[model samples]
Target: MIRSILLTAATGLLLSACAQPPLRGTGDLGVVIERASGSVQIIESDSHTALARLEGLGDLSHASVVYSRDQRYAYVFGRDGGLSKIDLLSQRIDRRVIQGGNSIGGAISQDGKLIAVSNYVPGGVKVFDARTLRQVADIPATPLADGSKRSRVVGLVDAPGQRFVFSLFDTGEIWSADFSQGASPKITRFNNIGQQPYDALITPDGRYYMAGLFGEDGMAQLDLWHPERGVKRVLGDYGRGQEKLPVYKMPHLEGWAVADNQAFVPAVGRHQVLVMDARTWRQTAAIAVAGQPVFVTSRPDGRQVWVNFAYPDNDRVQVIDTETHAVVADLRPGPAVLHMEFTARGDQLWLSLRDGDQVQVWDPYSLKPVSTLPAAAPSGIFFSSRAQKTGY
Candidate 1:
């Protein structure tokens, strides 16, 4: 009788232990893009360790990912027009579809109901149901008056009111499509924004959309709040009277940093970052940088702007103080530093070094290396926190 009672009590204790919820790991999860192998390394920002590696993603050379609203799904936009919906918790691809022949990147709707892809082959934006990956709407980049061929679309982003905005590389136009009404989206196109809008970014507040022009000296801005006022070209003639250097690679506008009402934008072919007043839309100052700047991203806390370069200087990264407008720290993580991502609270920074095949984490305030995780030709490091923001 004593033995049976002891066994029953032990079984009851085991069941009680199992009934309690499993201890949750740190919620700071993210993914690092392995461009060469077409895979992504799931990592925890706090632990600085890779939890899993998901493979078989096609042509991730220029891949980008946006997370679902609940932070459970990752919508990966592949260079080959493949839209893959990944389950972050399960570390598996939930659903995927070939949306187009060639694609650049994509965005998720504000409400997490839709996903939009910018295409290079068909020259248009295709919207898909975020849950089912079903085709919802297709808006073509129609030809402008100067040409009969459709233009390639790039710089796609989600806005506040269930709208997706993008720029046309060939037509020099910016467009916004409203999907609040469902399958048939209402479209608005602004013309003559600039020449060769290589990339674009929407401000965090979702009020302004800025496109970096490669063929011209400045950028194009659209006030989303007042679209009838049309697109305004700002920072024009920035490189006037100076022989601009040949651009080896187009600087990405997605890296443009905005902090404390100032915008730090990469000067196309110059080894400098252009500072502009976000309110006035005027050039405030130019900070000389190490090399041709590609991404000038502001830290989450708005205290510093981190800048990365292209090609020859791609191995280095520089941080600028927002208050002083000065280059603070110049860091060399490794060769071919492709991207940088800060933790949601701005405590740490994760940088991907393609040539080194590793991701380095550092203290954002002290500029000290904290940890490193091995990866394979990593490019973009995206955090799950991005699921809550307008544009990631």
Candidate 2:
């Protein structure tokens, strides 16, 4: 009896300790997940170490991660259609939500109230309650050009009026859905925005949503409020065919960032990040990079841009000075720089190196690698603020 009582007391004490709020600023690093390795590492600002490494939730190499607005939780989605809720404070997976069907990508609302994931095979977007990570609604697949197959929601953006905008790679269209209610949500066909719309980012003010058109002239900009306003071509051709070519054979625009009244687009074929003014929608500058860059993200402070390339030999992360519009540094992290993300505070950068089977951390300002974290087939990563400790 005495031993059992003591053991119970010991366990209670440990649980109490785990329940306390984690060291602040540690969570400031936000969230990062490596798709191939099925590993997610969270680092706080400038911390020489990682706060927590949540592992084995699912196959991360093909998953997409997003942080809740409160920065407390991370929602992970696998390409096979598995969703897991991770507790940021405890550094453990809380539960798994089976989103029946294959997923291409997913996103969390800025308000942290909802999460929506694309089901490619079935052609639909599943919306869930941010708190419970429970399915609230399933928006059906929006139509596309005939014979194009239901375009997968490769990229999604939450907008006003409980509406979410998703991009389709197959048909080059953007669809809008409403998830105001917990069930029976409404979906609408917004417009055919561009060709091969892979990713999108909304302006800070929510005035416009810009979709990166891969293998096209440039970014296709749409009025978030009025999707029927047709579309405007923002950045110029990325030099796909000679100096300038017809729209059909344009090289392509893959990754993009909207900041400081300019949209920074990474033209993979051109090996350049074309900058365009948001208001005037004119070409401002073209920043050259090392290899076929895949992603262009803003520095934590939003003052600089970071470009990452793909495998089998993209061992470096390129840093571009947004102010000067110049390539500043190339950070050699390791093998295969597949996908990467930055913590909320922007103090640390997380990289998914496919060949290395590791997720690397870097100092955004100094361009120095801070640590190497374990991950499997590291792929998609996103930050979440609404995570919480769910008693398992």
Candidate 3:
């Protein structure tokens, strides 16, 4: 009878142990790319703490990450053409595949069904199944008349209605591939868009697509709602008749900000952000900034615009007031401020200081440091909130 009682008590203890609740996870989470180590630090945005560090990613020197629709998986694109699907919940790379010799970046389809990667080595865009990472389509960049099939692809982005749009750096053309049907994608090519379309970006509403030209003075714009109008060149002759300074780094079009029917664009080889009226597509104002601006990103709430510089001025960041179009704050965050990411609600801004070897969180309103997380050569800070947006 005593033995039976002891067995019953042991079984009861085992049952109690099994009934213990699992650790709860915070929903506001992000990932910091450790470029040199080829790893990422999973951080909780609300608590501003590192939860886990994942490694084994290859050649992340120029890495970019996009999250799955559910924000449970991160699709990391490596410089060496490695695509890794990391399960953020488990902090492990669930699937990986070498897609090419060199890849620039990637995007996820609107419906969360496909993943597209832009390449440079072979010069084309490859689309894969988002769930399985299986190659579905190989849209090779159109060759020039001189029989060169090696036009480097850049500024690849996913548009609404299952379409992928990108530009050819060498060919000066933009192509949109519609994948609504199946693995075979229908292509729509726009020729002679401009000279050296360095990078491109689509508006948040997915209505307009713009490409920044490196070999010319202005940029090219296209209306996705009406592609029949062809590509229109705007911001005309912004660099005409001037002995321009040699560009140390190409300005990123992804940093362009759209708020209140106006767009803030970083001028190439100039220390200014061109404000254009979205309704008329004309330059409204030129907001002077410190040094050459590389990224002019807007706050999530569209209340302010944040500008970061290149090279000599990379250590400084400036915030611009959207209403007054003036520089409100000039902050020297740290050395080598490579990237900045805002929280989902825009309450906090996270910065990656590559030279400082740390990631700093700051209150966007006060522009004051909230916390610092130790890192190793951090460059890009990506938040899971980007999962719902296109062209993150």
lDDT of 3 at 157: 91
Total backbone collisions for each predicted model:
0, 26, 0
**lDDT string, candidate 2, 176-207, tens digits:** 67666645666566555667776676665656
Which lDDT values do the candidates have, in the order given? 0.88, 0.67, 0.88
Candidate 2, TM-score vs. the true structure?
0.79
Tell me, by TM-score, which candidate is best.
Answer: 3
lDDT of 2 at 363: 80
| Model 2 misplaced stretches (Cα beyond 4 Å) | 1-26, 51-55, 143-149, 236-255, 311-313, 374-377, 380-392
Q: What is candidate 1's lDDT per residue for 164-263, written digit by digit as tens?
A: 9999999899999999897899999998888888888899899999887767677788999999999987888543224377676677777888888898
TM-score of 1: 0.91
Pairs that collide in candidate 1 are none
Per residue, candidate 3 scores C-alpha lDDT tens digits across 46-101 of: 88999899999999998999988878889999999999998777777889999999
Candidates in descending TM-score order: 3, 1, 2
Q: What is the lDDT of residue 58 in candidate 1?
A: 92
2 or 3, greater by TM-score? 3
